[model samples]
Target chain A: MDPQKTGFDYSTFNPSYFQHLEQRIKDLDALGIQADLILFHPYDSWGFARMGQAMDKHYIQYIVARLASYKNIWWSLANEYDLMAQLGQKPLSAWDFIGKTVHQEDPSGHLLSIHNFYDPPVHKGTTKNWFDYTKPWITHLSIQSDNVFFVPKWLDDFQKPIIFDECRYEGNIEFGWGDNSAKGMVDSFYRIVLRGGYATHGETYIDKPNTTRPIWWAHGGILRGESQKRITYLKQLLATNGFNYVNPMAVQGPHWELAVGESPDKQHVFAYIGDNQPEFEIFDFLPKDNIYSAQVIDTWNMTSTKLNERIDKNHYFHIPRKPYQAILLTKIN
Target chain B: MDPQKTGFDYSTFNPSYFQHLEQRIKDLDALGIQADLILFHPYDSWGFARMGQAMDKHYIQYIVARLASYKNIWWSLANEYDLMAQLGQKPLSAWDFIGKTVHQEDPSGHLLSIHNFYDPPVHKGTTKNWFDYTKPWITHLSIQSDNVFFVPKWLDDFQKPIIFDECRYEGNIEFGWGDNSAKGMVDSFYRIVLRGGYATHGETYIDKPNTTRPIWWAHGGILRGESQKRITYLKQLLATNGFNYVNPMAVQGPHWELAVGESPDKQHVFAYIGDNQPEFEIFDFLPKDNIYSAQVIDTWNMTSTKLNERIDKNHYFHIPRKPYQAILLTKIN
Candidate 1:
């Protein structure tokens, strides 16, 4: 926190210090990584101390309004937080303010929200009370392993388009650390899209993930651009799929499966088995005409392959269970 | 990242001392996270090298042998690797090692798998020929999000326990730090369980989390913890009541009506609407015996009323549209 901006050692960064933040926002404008709630100032103890109840609410109002001035940045919100409440914390209250102030300036509200996790939403109905239907709702990127893809259910009921407020990449290589240490990067992506929802990642070291050490960037993999390259494809593929068609349904066979996108109706059927060398078939109950042929969309290279005849209803073509591959069988049309 | 045992070096914890090479893995026992990985012996480079194979059936042999010693660490097998023909990165191979080496050590092979978002298993049934069906499986985890609880679908597939393998928890308050950071810790719990699985998180710091940020635990509110408290609770609840109970069918109604919890039997039902002010009797549905008594598990402490609801098909209860709370209506026991 560059505390000089707010004057108390300025934990606030003026529109000055890093041209990167502004440029990145512009690039996001170009790439459409636009959602709301981008945090510039992290936990500023000084700012928090001086502002008190007025501290963040006033600062967030300043931050969001300033960012709102530029179309490049649409999300205007703060931590509106509550993860650690012991510090006389008041992020959520500020969110109440954000909910009120943001819409007053931008009707569509620029897809904004605050960041939170470890803690579920304390202020749920506030957004609906303040912003109109067009305004997006804010929510955290649920990170617990058991909470895999839990946000969709939260958002489904939230009655608003949720921007995954904060999703961190973490990996702990036993021996404690080093190479292959961070997690929450690509794996978190799998959880996000199971229900055809969207979420964002807060890269630990934004500009250069490598600048960090054994744990942050870890291994020479960063040199290989391992995390970056894979995530780009995932983001594009999920975004391209158009969430509507990817509804959640239970698909069980010799093994467990969760699938999105129905076979014929949506012009395609996509099935994903989360784990196991699930021995099963492609078409167990086909209505004949709905079968257009099965193709495995290998996400790694975006590889597309058409299957031969073993994939029929009676045969139960063996699906050599692999992780997160999108199998789509188009309508014969 | 163990600054003490990381085997790496830092320029007094500043940018100039960014660590590039690891010291050495003299004894495999001291290899994990105990010793620093950056303190490369200025006089020697290859002194600290992990045994990874680009060339033989015994490829993962060395590391496997070490882990077989039964250390108490969650291990992941390969890093984010894909066999790409177009990029001349094809001729890829890895299965033999994981099957023989990793599997032998951890019967629950998922503890080790590739870290990826879009990448599928290239090692599944390849010619190096090391995969079999104790479960022919692949593990998936999305280290994509900044949210600690959010996991990608790739890791959600484990019909059994699955480690998030790679998650990022820097405890950096770039957004609003502190307890807000706990959201990642809390969300990470439910995210994995709802997917019918168990999970893990990755943290980044110079020392053991407990040692450094003694309070920064990855629990209901921090980046460090003895166990994922809330995550365990949520997962236990879902597992106890079939995961399918939380399926999301559709949102139909005047308020924000939506359904979640999915099971093959479709016996369990969860529904929520955002009209907290609605005036409907709890059991407006007559002949409540026809349907299961709805039990709303206060997973997120949203309610403390207790599980005491009598039911009938005519149940018309007023519920608020919220997150982390689910209502289960099952056939009466």
Candidate 2:
């Protein structure tokens, strides 16, 4: 990418760029971080994004040849592919060609996806559903959405794994996408997870003037945000007691936000209350003999407290006086 | 409401209830708060919501007879009418009757609306758009939505004045609908406003155990939250320079969230940037002869610093490193 910046000159292909990427991946592996590699992006000051189809094919092949062996690598065909089209640079067919190229050439079968963003004038009338999720080359849907409400529909529409790759970052940077608070970031993480999808974490902290370097979002560097720690806590919670195995159940009635993830036998129930709701009665839809133990989870504070000793029939729970609260119910054997 | 809690008993209606209501209206007038009176709500422990059609008509007529004279009153047919139906007490026909009765009986012709909520099982497959904005009895759409993204669509769908009556209260309450933070509340308020809709503010802070009383959202004692002052600031911003009069311009291309409000002559341009957005060149879209003076409005902190002396074409202004930041452009002759 560095050498080809002047133009898509094949003569400028230096092995050092791949060496640096390989080294970075190894470092990321050390920290147990999965690297979602973007092969082409319009964030280019370089001419790499405007390369001809042949050059694009050459670059895609080169990237796969160098980095396909890594277990943590994911192939994001392009970052904001829609933005590129909006800028009148690359068209969808180019992305299709590049994606097919990556899918065919990568023998290790690293997960393939393409990042998308809203075209400007984000008002409601101008907004369009731009992504083709059913593409055979796409392994999963990677999205950057302004709202989380539409995620469920996308989940149902595509019937594939959905990843909230960009739900705004946690930082005080000069961009809206990177200025979300740690609490907001974690809240989105839980919201997506509760709704039967996944979300990724990024940080973009701006330090004292001229001291800001190696932003965690763009430039690979040390993590300096609070969300990662809380996300670690969430990851721990998901892995424990086989909690990660459950999928969100079909909810009916007025409490539309009461997103519940239940195990097959209905033994474990994780209910996420997104915002503050008034007092309501929660019916135990579990088996007749099952006595459910419910605990209040303060998601932001990462604390779990026992709410009730046993709930048999309908139980009245005064939801916490806070946002991002959840009720974790594990049935007593 | 307290005395008639047993049922819509006409015998229980006393002169003292009207006297108390008149005094409350006077008190609300003193505080400059327009009263949104609920004719019926599902929160009643009393049988008011389950009244027969005849009793419902009687109650509606009584309410109109007593309170319709107040100029500040807005009739809310019921709080979460669909919720009442889901509770198996009141049906939609009952709500339709109540709404029509309120519409016909009230001589003052105060704004009439009905509140709605989401049904549970938060997935997109189950989410239903239940509000009939086109109803003849309805004055405007009164909505309680979890996501603010739908506001623009609602504005378009109904083509009537939209009020986000309950877009989640700002508090740490155990309910997701009432536990939003002051910052989140203000952000939503601005978001709704920029998108050509109105939002209301409420608070529900629960103090230490057993000491909590008079929730600002329910009981309405005193203003205990921070959003009111910020909302006042927003109201002031809207009032100043007639900024509230402009509708958001149609945005095209990559910057989907550039919510703009401009004067009729295209002289005064108000652009709000929510969250941290990556850099984009802000072009001077006004007339050629006019010299535009730009200032950065820090919506959260209430600061407006002079940004540019004059912006012509392709102006590059780095947005503030914060959420809810705005760039206010005024034409200086």
Candidate 3:
């Protein structure tokens, strides 16, 4: 796969690659998708993973220089840098060079994070002090575990945005990390959001034996999964409502998760309950003296129904019998 | 109200109380249910939770003296003992006294453990060095979290028997800890067993508003939940198949959990695939040289079907498309 040794010198600096990437970014931007541009990944066998320091630095500069103008582009240093280290393939100095080069060259200072692999010695990358949240170059925390319980710890540690980049894919593949039912994927999405974080979507449905090689998880082509439509609904809701003000609140139940968003003037209270029927009372979390018109939101169906009765801290309203439900309490003033 | 303050001088030493408890133990023993007799609990409002040290010591001795004769009696010093300390109701010395008194007085030396409640100052009880597994009084570790991922950590920490006595009850109660669905409860049961630990079962389905106050969780009554049947199936399978020798094995997938069990003669391999439709290759975990007959076990439905084909490391077999499937490979010598 080394074209340089064959006297062709096929490099990432080729003008055709950026032209294609630029077109892809524009197409994604039109669809309201942010391009998470992973500059270096360890999956390649073409000697691209173990590139020399000088070539790596030049490649990072060229990529960032071309893509930094787009507002929708995010700079991901590598797909699984820890895995690269575990293979005894790359050195920390090379990763530092690439990260620093990307951070310094990109004028937009777009969101930057590195994806991680699970279990050590592959997980040793994030344990280093240089990967600390104090580092200004890294914009957010990107993790690849189904353990959402670590969300709070990372939130407190980083004090930055948390992105669950890989929380298992919605597909019927053989591998554990990639095979999740549509319902399971949807539950993970709600969990990440309720924990005050962002989640990435991926699918790996094996179309046939040898035909499904370029899957959505690796190649990123057509999304032939059910979660996309539901995620779009959530995205639209977040965009329409005051989602920026929302914060994850400590909930008492083991199965239930809660998030509250209220304006400074306290006109509305948005509470999101996750993965359980809302049969319990949320009256204590509501304002004591205000009469509020409440609406129960069926998350899966993406429908909201208004109640005829007014609710206050003293009153209890019936929560619909469903797996996942939310209530929006708005001050009627 | 305390009868002692009311001039009646009622104590735990009442012969009538012992007679009733003895009868209850005999009944439980007949039914093969080991009674986890909690001598002290924080929920008691009848002055039982805040008994003085002398009275508590006497209570523990009298209770153990009568109950130790039964083969099925296990001493649990307190239910949520940490919660008692958190409420500023009981001191650590009192707990130490009760634990020590029970361990010394009980001649049967039945399994002894202590249950812990979560959150701080309630969680502070186990943080002390006295609660360390090295303490001879504590025979096992009792925990109450849905995080089965911590099972390995506790296993390593205690080096003793680990019993997940309360990993949330199966019910629709308002409290988060007591309201897991039957399916969720069953999954937790598998997780506990796969991790080489013991789990306890309890039911909390609300019968009515005020009329059904005697829940199976608190007062002993008729069991009213769906998980009992499934748990019984698992119990019988484990009992017949020598599941005690099995250990949790490291699995690569995010959704899949694997446990391997082999008979004394190495004639059988029981691989438990948890929480995923088993579609992958189990060839690597199979004994490469031996031909084995495989059966797919549907844990929820409690059914096992034998496949016509024999399996080895080279051959892949079809697994049914469903969550929570297990495969048993017995040596076809």
Candidate 4:
């Protein structure tokens, strides 16, 4: 009942408010952002088919479904729905209904998937029934794990490729922020890929409403906006030329010791990781040994660009680190 | 308004309810663990401290302070206050006020903490802050790690030994209710302590609200009411003889190939952290290999349990383990 509190509020409605949605869609059309990931939270929208009393919440839910019907929108039923539901919390049902409504509304094709905090169970004999195949359905998860649970648990069974909505929790070279915890990220990347899968190592963030929190935006400092570091790093990396996603099979590994990103042709690329010994985990996942160039991106400055020159399996890297740093390697065809 | 449908109803309040508070305190003490965490919606009890009701909803605060006045009842304040404030969805005043008022009420020693979906920041300077030892406080966190924030960050630095107020996020393991997910609890116990700090790894049940989860009651399915395996294992290895904690400094160089526990008198009591080659980092931390006995109890379990059969470290240990479990070793003082 307390609007400023953290549970579901009954007022974020007003379906007639769709009056502005048309213009908002047109505005997004000009931005060229490609797609809007609309994470649907119906219960939060105050719309419940079960709630027969208030027409306001119901109307608001309708407007939400209608707006998401516009082009350039990908519908993630709800952000981390599995986690929420498992915790015995209620979310909006409008997601499944929204997907159906979006198709009936526009029909050009609307992407649908549940934005889960981890690999959602591909229900018994219902993997296909769970998501829209028009676009990839990715579940957000952490790549900062010692074991590669994403691929086997979710991706391997999916008909469409699964993108790791959130593979890394912290990324960046700044202090205060979690930029200092990259070791786990670098390790998890290869572990996921080498086991055969795709994941987006994106960071997530939250901010306050009116005032501002340093790391996040709001005074309460909860998740609200886009995670800055991973987004920036991703957009830049994807923009680079001659770089492509690597293959899991390409790496010769008994147990992948590195994270590698190779070209589509497997001709030009590089893989590496960081550990106590300036050594990288690359060889653990690679098949070929006749190496190209080897470099160590100082964790302190990932943008500096340096190389360890030629290296082999017999050697342990000599680069010494005081902690809170990493080693990056680059290679070309 | 719709209590059955699950939202808290607020229209039922009567101001005269507070005049009889002395009895509420008596009841709480008598019916302690029998009750759920008293849900403190401060705005519900006391209204109009009036910081512009326009900005927040902190009315039920008096109730919390009043309840804390009684001994033996544990409680969680408004579920997720941060998210509520953001949507203009809830009363900001409750949080704003409770943040200040709870201290005034619980000054005589009571457990306190917020149940954030993820880990929230510890208020920097508090008279009864978790770090300052002003009081024994707990952070309400989970085990499955929903899309919220990370849990380890809070557990590692939390001052009063931490407790996983809600550890059921991992209820469904490996996509099913019983797919070897129980291993997760074990792995989590190791991960929490080895990587960071102490955790009272208990869980909640829709079936048994009053009873502790299996981990706490069963001890990895061993005892009927406690986790003997967990406690005994940790005590022997990490909290050697209860005099001191196992330290990270015991590991000599990079390999982190070893881990150790020593007596306050500077004698090695345990060391088994390495690969097949046995890179015990405790070499330097050991006290001149003084005569001692290394007793490997249940060495068959990969999580082998061994003990320092004596009071010194002059002995060598050859611990054989089962296929998949943790191996524990102890040096006799």
Candidate 5:
């Protein structure tokens, strides 16, 4: 069981670890949740992160063989792969080998990705610090950035399911990565989802009196933040509308400041104006021939109100001039 | 005077225009205000923006000769000079010539700068869209960007007085540049000023019912936004504390998420936690020898409360988990 022992010693491998993972995956599957497992992380003081390439590949193979059969499994090679590489604990070649081993060994062909640590400098909607997500073994992008505005550009470049796995957390913790307010977290979630990407939520509220209790971000515990109900509302709205994917609207008017997304069929459009509270917005991009039933949604309050008057391309939809307001447009004919 | 006319004909020069400008400058001087005179702009239906290089130079000479005597005048060569250049109405050389002409004609040597339209791509804290403020004739950097986070870098690069003349406006207008909320405007001002720069406030609240009234941003009429009082509070706070310039703190702990600034003498520090609501923060970066009195400021509500306990390097400051809160530390011993 010693991590310092590099070569794969099957005789010494623990069966209880596999059993725990299998049970967890089964429970998550029953709950209709995807279990995004991190195979490596730099927050370890042990020698496991420093395991040689051969041992790493063997470990990946063993995990894939044991847990890849679960329908809910998503393979995250590392929490912060860049940090591991920077620390010289693992090289880029080792990550590639691990990814290839996981891909080859997994019969289920589950979602495979690696999370990044270096937040690439975004200039004119371009970045270079991402772990070449274009690689053959990488199935999708697992990003760690606060700039969800780049989701549209990433969708264009990668053409894959991009998940901002870590856009900080909703909490009152002291660290920068874990102290975002509930409203900020909800705003980020809507921004990411409406721009044709996905976001993962985490909570890091420090437990008072009994400060030793595990936080929801690191260890499973009670959800203390208020973003969960709003996120559920967003999910229900999208699912009820039968919208599987919504790309950013192509027009360049309100879309410059608003996160406006249209379904591939072009029948449903959702625009989230996060902070701006314009009194009325003209949707000149909507087809002139189509009539739309507009609904103003209060994202924070989890309420949707249907407008009495139908709207066309020529008309402006009057809004209540409030923050965290979203407008949903459904074509009537 | 016809805007289409090219050369500066003394016979046709309008004395009334000069008289009006003189009166306005005098009025502003009496009110202890600096009149930032924009000599050229692209929002023109007339041919004045299309004036030839000679006429542009002549106009600059005339304006500078007439207005330079006033102590409260700042020569902004053009509003969005880049837009004028992009329109092919004026070239870069023409701007350089105009800037040089203004510098030569203004014997009083008032503050001289040019605004830009191109929102530069900021990557790793570097931008290229700014007009060359390095030129000796330009006294300061007049910027038109919404990102006040880059003020520290801009201060480092330009080493000139930086004023974000248009970080959007405080209003509910339809335009993106004029639709920021009052809280957002106040946040931008603190972010700019804390990083050792300045910000100018503009309001674009559309007057309901009386829709034809001039907005404060373009044509000054009445200020309707709630940000003005908060900005005045900020100005009074800085002035009362005798803080001329406070650069962003060099250390990178809480400063990563918080806008923390320190006076050049290192005796005073101001930290603005814009959206984060951390319950407490540990300031280990402060000098261990200095004893300081700390005050928690509710920036939006315009209230300040002093903490009874003096803090040195070893203590953690307990804070209420709230948004738009700022902390001020002043040396007492």
Candidate 6:
């Protein structure tokens, strides 16, 4: 527990910490939430972040052995692992050893990944500072980039489920990584989800002087952002439509202006117009022979209106000329 | 002017074409506007784009001799010169020759430049396909990118005047490059101008079947978009304030989230909260020793409201918590 120690004393380790973690995992599992446990982080004043490789390996093995049996557990090896490496607390080989140890120790074969910090100078659009996601022990990619439009390329480059775990939170905090507006957050989610990836949400609203409420991103408390409900509506929309897999239609003509996606069977199509507010769009990208029922979705207001006119390749559909609008088309016959 | 011909006969070259260009240049000069004449383009079937080096040199010489006498004329050697190179109509060496020819032939020495087509695969953040802006003959940059956020980087890299001449037009056309909403266009202008660059505006709303109207971007017509007034307002604001040179405050703390800029003398500071609707921002970035008057500008509404409270490093300035709002601070003492 000393701040200057370089090794963990196993005999003096508290058992109550493991018990609290288990109880929290059980509670999250009951609520149908996956416990994405971050085992290492650089934002520490204690000596845990500076522990040498041997003690770090022992810590990872202990946690994986005790927690991997739960059905809803995702192992995040570290939050901002690159930052830790930059500070000389750990090296790339240390991360590799820790990852391999977790992969071998976990009996349940849970999802294992490492989150990264996006330092623009070193990690701008390139994976120069990222942990090797192509390693067999890593299950998926937990990225920290604000450019959600690049998700399609990342998905193509590494054939794994990509989760933008930190695309800048939805709040009014001063930091750049924590002060995106609600509309910005919703747009990022739609952009990523429509391109067959996932986005995580966080908030960092500074509380008033009298109120002692914790910021949602640092210490979990009551949710105070407007993006949560819209995100839930998006989730329900995807689940109801049975769109398990949607890929961006980059080769199609309209994809350049709109975030257009299509299901594998070519029956469901959706396009998210993020900031462009065109009054009307010609639906020439639709199939020529198939008839489709069109619906306009106001992502911000969480409203869906079915258009009276059925759409085909020849028809032009009029829109409300507003931002944060989407169109969903389902094959009718 | 024949579509199939590869050579130009000087005897048959129309004198009226030169006269018409001179008249147009005079008209634009009367309005205090610069005529950015594009000498060559690839969107042609007239074989002008594929003209050999000899004819190309002759054409450049003729235009520069006839047009460079006007003070308002800016020599854009070619529009989308990279696309011309990609299509094998002109290589880089040919463009260099054309630019050098224009530089040498123009007796009046008008501003000379070349515009580029942004093919994402080849020119994403890297200047691989861009014309060598470092050449002595080139005076400024005319870019075709929608990412106005990268203007600051381009300004640093090239150290030349940057103009996003084709950051997508404000319209409802079918083409991606010709269809951005009015709000989108205004936002692009603000982002670029705030970062000490310039942006050009265009409109491309498709007309009804019965009405035969030309697209503004293709053939000059009546103005229709809402962005023109806001851009004019921004121009007046800058002109009245005498901010001839403003640089981005990237090293400051709040610049990561807000588009903050300062005049070279640091007597004027402006921040554009483009899409972020923060309720209140702590004015800790301001100098503690100076007293300043603050104003909130509704960029889209073209309205400015002066605040009752003065600002310094100690005060927290509250905002309207809406999109497209800006804060302007002027040191009074």
Clashes of each: 155, 35, 1, 61, 0, 0
- C-alpha positional error of residue B214 in candidate 4 after TM-score superposition, expressed in Å: 44
Candidate 3 collision pairs? A253-B176
Error of 6 at B308 (Å): 4.2
lDDT of 6: 0.79
Q: Sorted by lDDT, highest first, which candidate order results?
A: 6, 5, 2, 3, 1, 4
lDDT of 5 by residue, B186-254 (tens): 999888888788899988777442367767766775687899999999888887776777777633433
lDDT by residue (A206-248, candidate 1, tens digit) is 2222224543332322433245665677556545544353554
Best by TM-score: 6
Displacement of residue A77 (Cα, Å) in model 4 is 1.5
Chain B in candidate 6 has what TM-score?
Answer: 0.91
- Candidate 2 has a TM-score of 0.71
Over 4 Å off in model 4, which ranges?
A1-16, A19-39, A42-71, A83-106, A117-149, A152-154, A166-238, A249-256, A275-291, A304-333, B1-333
As a whole number from 0 to 100, the lDDT of residue A266 in candidate 2 is 67
Interface RMSD of 6: 3.6
Give me the overall lDDT of model 3: 0.68
lDDT of each: 0.39, 0.71, 0.68, 0.38, 0.79, 0.79
CAPRI grade, predicted model 2: incorrect
- Residue-level lDDT of model 4, residues A238-285, one tens digit each, is 336244544443232122223345556544344433232222222433
Candidate 2 at B80: error in angstroms?
1.6
Model 1 chain A worst lDDT run, 10 consecutive residues: A172-181
Give per-residue lDDT, candidate 5, residue B234: 88
Candidate 1 vs 4: which has more TM-score: 1
TM values, all candidates: 0.40, 0.71, 0.87, 0.38, 0.91, 0.93
Better of 4 and 5 by DockQ: 5
Docking class of 4: incorrect
Worst 10 residues of 4 chain A by lDDT: A171-180
RMSD of each: 27.7, 6.6, 4.2, 26.0, 3.3, 2.8
TM-score of 4: 0.38
Query: How high is the DockQ of candidate 4?
Result: 0.01
Q: What TM-score does model 3 achieve against the real structure?
A: 0.87
